[model samples]
Target: MAPVNEAARPALKAGTRDAHERRIDRAVALIERAIAQGEEPPELGRLAEAAAFSPFHFHRVYRAMTGETTGQTVARLRLLQGLRLLASERRSVTDAALAVGYQTPQAFTRALRQSLGTAPSELRAEPERLWREIDRLAQPPQPEQGEDAPPLRVEVVSIDPFQVVALRVEGGYEAKHAGYERLFGWAGAHGLLDRLQGLYGVAVDDRRDVAEPQCRFDCMLALGEGVDPTGLPGLRLTRLGGGRYARIRHVGAFDGLEAATDALLARWLPASGERLGDALLYHDYLDDPDQVPQALLRTDVYLPLQC
Candidate 1:
């Protein structure tokens, strides 16, 4: 999905409605602003105070809402800032460390190596190699199909047609989080969060056939009845036609979807005598990543099948 335009966001009303989302937004904004300003990491108590939450309950609330603890957020932002200073500003390791709130170059190098699998000096010396490593790390582990491993099970089922509000994005699938975040914020503002029925990811291009930078993805939220998106500017409504689909349950990180899909197409289809249908393949996300552990994230990959 494309990065959301800040101006396109709906104006939120002041009330008790969506109070949790508002607080989360405020906390996230505070953390981001502090990071961008090169200030020391905000204390947990300070962040909680800014979000109008008690420090005692703030950590659990932040983790439930954002999928990471407050300390993790701080560390991640600082690490990203350090990387930017090293890559874009061409700063030395020592300078980048201090600039990003690390006490010493050694500490910065240790964190960098832990996060990116490369030392700061190595990143400066061989940027391309670092990218290759990062890409390797991004790939999901391929499932082992040995005799001891269970076979990949696929169930063919008929699904009814559905209406969705989709945000089209052109780029790597890893970037879809921004689109989903925007959708969540919009839904919260409109008091439509409870009305959401499902979340779907439509893959417009096969990553194996298209370059990562040119791939297309759509982040879709399935709208329940009576939740009309009509007259809503910047909202694109799409109807997914009803059809027979081969569904494969994928259990793990989002990165594993591609590999699971590959397994379905390469191993299952030819053996099952199933022919492909005209409609695009998509994923039905069953668990919210923000609230679930990565190892337990569940998604159902649906491939349109010939009737």
Candidate 2:
């Protein structure tokens, strides 16, 4: 699924942004709940009401925040539900298709091809492989604001909620150095750079589905409550709720981050008997590319986990 190309929205005030995000979470939860019911799910108007937005506004707001249209999320959820049913062998293909709101097995198979890159029967026959190819499509590592673990070594740890002064950017990962420089300049000018304890990155959208030009990320520096930039231009302060997280280090370039994330999600997660946590994955920058070689640059990928 291609990322929707939407115009930039005005910057959000901290309180308003928090409320908006929470509402989005609520709206998504409702959608997921309906998907789990294995029924047609709720109507868009009802979903909007639950999210406290008009149907028209809700559609736009949802895409703005999550980098996906409401229809895409709903479709992905239904497809995943169908895939799970097939994997568990709990339902025949046709039954699974109907449960996910497909009117016919043919329609279901066609959707599976479009989204998962494989037919329903193919996915059922090779669940793990199919899962590897399509997992990011469902929920790529996301940002809930947290950072560094050891390379390839998986560790489980708890994170206390923290705050950061962040600027959202769009474009290539390395091209984001300009964005980082702007952030550093702001912090330096305010005398906050030296006091900063950690530098972090939030993968706001998955590149697999988002065009490079449209990818959104947050360049953040750890800022305590005492250092508020309430009215700072191009900067916002947000809190990422903390919990248990599965942390792993990705050595080498950011380009390979996807495979590293996949290792954790597709390989390590199921074997650990742990479930994916609600928060998005965060990157803790360990070395500066300007100072160190790209091959040696390191980042810690943190995957929030259900404890």
Q: Could you estimate the TM-score for every candidate?
A: 0.49, 0.53
Report RMSD for candidate 1: 19.5
> Model 1, which residues run further than 4 Å from truth?
1-150, 226-234
* lDDT over C-alpha atoms for residue 36 of model 1: 71
Best candidate according to TM-score: 2
Q: What is the lDDT of candidate 2?
A: 0.70
TM-score of 2: 0.53
Deviation in angstroms for 141 in model 2? 20
lDDT per residue for candidate 2 within 1-307, as digits (tens), equals 0112222223243455456557677888888888777666678788777877656345544554565667678888888777777776768989888877888989889998887677877777886876764565568234321124333467777777788778888988665787788888888888887787677888776676579999888888886767767545778887653777777788898887766765565445534555555575788888988898989989888777665
Off by over 4 Å in 2: 1-152
- Highest lDDT: give the candidate number: 2
| lDDT score at residue 240, model 1, on the 0-100 scale | 68
